[model samples]
Target: MRRTLGRMLADSRTQPAHAPGASNDPLILREARADDMPAVLDIYNAEVRTSTSTYQYAERTLDEQLALLSSKQTAGDPFVLAELADGSVGGYATYGPFRPREGWRFTVEHSVYLREDCRGKGIARPLMRHIMGHAKARGFHSMVGVVDASNAASIRMHQAMGFQVAGVMREGGYKFDRWLDCAFLQALL
Candidate 1:
């Protein structure tokens, strides 16, 4: 994870910062292209392996990520990548239906992940602001996130971003041979 962070930060520093107020930092949030898949996959797989940001244990193949992105593109959903001025992807954020039921159509669950070193640089705040703006513009009424209980930094970030702590599910998952608790945060768009 440290190695991944190091690489991301290094890449971030090499790129130029986006011009002020250029719509979520063009250097950060842009429609992801096909070539960005590899960098996205690396960041995603690293999170899966080292943190509870995702529940999956297996690393996703490039093909899988591409398919997912393709589906999002087809649906016109936001699949944004945070890139440095030199165009390396530093992180990503996106959302899908919170549930498959028709009644839940106005609600969605989203996730944002940044390479460790890319954190604390005001990257996530802008990324999330753009995501929420897109969701609201698209008529989504509610946005949700399920965060592992142990990830305080993420919880704080969510709170600071105007997401409330909706609830916590205790002992909801077993990972690494131990029970894990998960918290749900929600923001009304």
Candidate 2:
């Protein structure tokens, strides 16, 4: 029972001038639309197939993306997509339970991805802040970001957002024919 992008935007009482003109800003952060599946999937699959941002070795099907959207919508998770000035989906961010156990309910893990061309335009900070506020309002006590050890940009961004490196799991993941370390960072809400 996910809502359409049109309805979501129209019903959003706090929609923050996403268009280009008076704001002079072209980037739009909003709830992901079903029509944006292809672009979002392309972005995710590219990372899954190439980068260490995601450890999954296989690309996901469109149906998987649809299912994810449905689940997030049902759970009231904050899944947002970034739209470029030209209306293309440039990136996305979402968070889910850090662990499934009842005692872990107060913690969550977040992931943010931006298209190569769209990086460094000051998009991630606001997006992360928005999600942080949403999680805080929902009574989450902390947020965790598990980053690839070699992803300096992501680590820096998390640090800038007040997340501290909790620990590192040495050689925690195996991908692309090599072992990858994961850096765990946490921020108390």
Candidate 3:
């Protein structure tokens, strides 16, 4: 079945956080609210500290995160959260205009961050699929992901979702006392 924002939003509204004694926990994708900022920020900041996934050197402040959340919400951009069946925030995905130029209106660049413990749990693929469906519904023509060159798992996942590597910028980013290459992966809506 196709995933749509409307369907996910409805599911978010109706699904209970968890069923008592349930052995398997389902993944839930929903629009992020202001209250979700703390959890989202924690996931992002952890990546900032330990990974090359983001080129940022300093950890993001909560106020800054709050402002970003507010802006995305106001602009109707997709800023979504992925929660466990127990209602704990495990990850988040968001996208914004690829560039400020008018011609770039139909393109977006996205980011996904998952908590350390959430890796390999099959969360990212669904979150990305949701973002693509949501963006396509909003009239976007393409979505891009700028992933670290060394992140083969992420590249493979995007490839599975129909994204292709468009280009690579060698040593385009610096973090952790070394240069990092960034690969641009694009998918048509």
Candidate 4:
């Protein structure tokens, strides 16, 4: 599965056998597109506004989302989308360089965001699986996730997928009027 980024991008969408929660619409895993920015931003901006899922204090605008997408694309990172049959985005996943230094080239930091209504519905498993596969295919030696300590659900999900707690940065972030601890999880690819 050592596919080039172009080939991965050209791959067709998949209608997963997953039947998340009570919903009958089986999600499709596909490469994100420019037109999908609005839906993707809705899911991300919501987290920025309401949860510790993202540490950003302000919601992103459409232009900002597009710019982020462009940066990811330029860096050869994969941004995946989980979509229902009706075309609504349920979640998104992506990974980028762990750091700007060349020594960190073999490691990547990933992010996965699912809509609030879509959580605990088994949607995350497939999204993470795809992203992991994509990273491995690209020859990344390791994948990492820096999650908020309060986000037990996300940490658990990563652990279930072979990620181990690397360490914890005590009070690494401040948001919502308090300091939030950050848990670092790593998985060998």
- lDDT tens readout by residue for model 4, 61-98: 99999998999999888899989777888899999989
Give a tens-digit lDDT track for model 1, residues 1-189: 334333433433333222123244455579888898999999999988888878888899999999999999998888898888777778889988999999999999998989888887777777787788888889999999898867777866776677766766878977777788787878778
The collision pairs in model 2 are: none
Q: For every model shown, what is its TM-score relative to the native structure? A: 0.85, 0.85, 0.85, 0.85
Off by over 4 Å in 1: 1-26
- Prediction-by-prediction clash tally: 0, 0, 0, 0
The sequence of per-residue lDDT tens digits that candidate 3 reaches over residues 142-189 is: 899898877877776676667776777878998888888787878778
Error of 3 at 120 (Å): 1.2
- Misplaced by over 4 Å in model 2 are 1-26
What's model 3's overall lDDT?
Answer: 0.79
Q: Candidate 2 or 3, higher lDDT?
A: 3
Cα lDDT computed for each candidate against the true fold:
0.78, 0.78, 0.79, 0.79
Question: Cα RMSDs of all predictions?
Answer: 9.1, 11.7, 10.6, 10.7
What's the true lDDT of residue 108 in model 3? 97
What is the alpha-carbon lDDT of model 2 when measured against the actual structure? 0.78
Off by over 4 Å in 4: 1-25
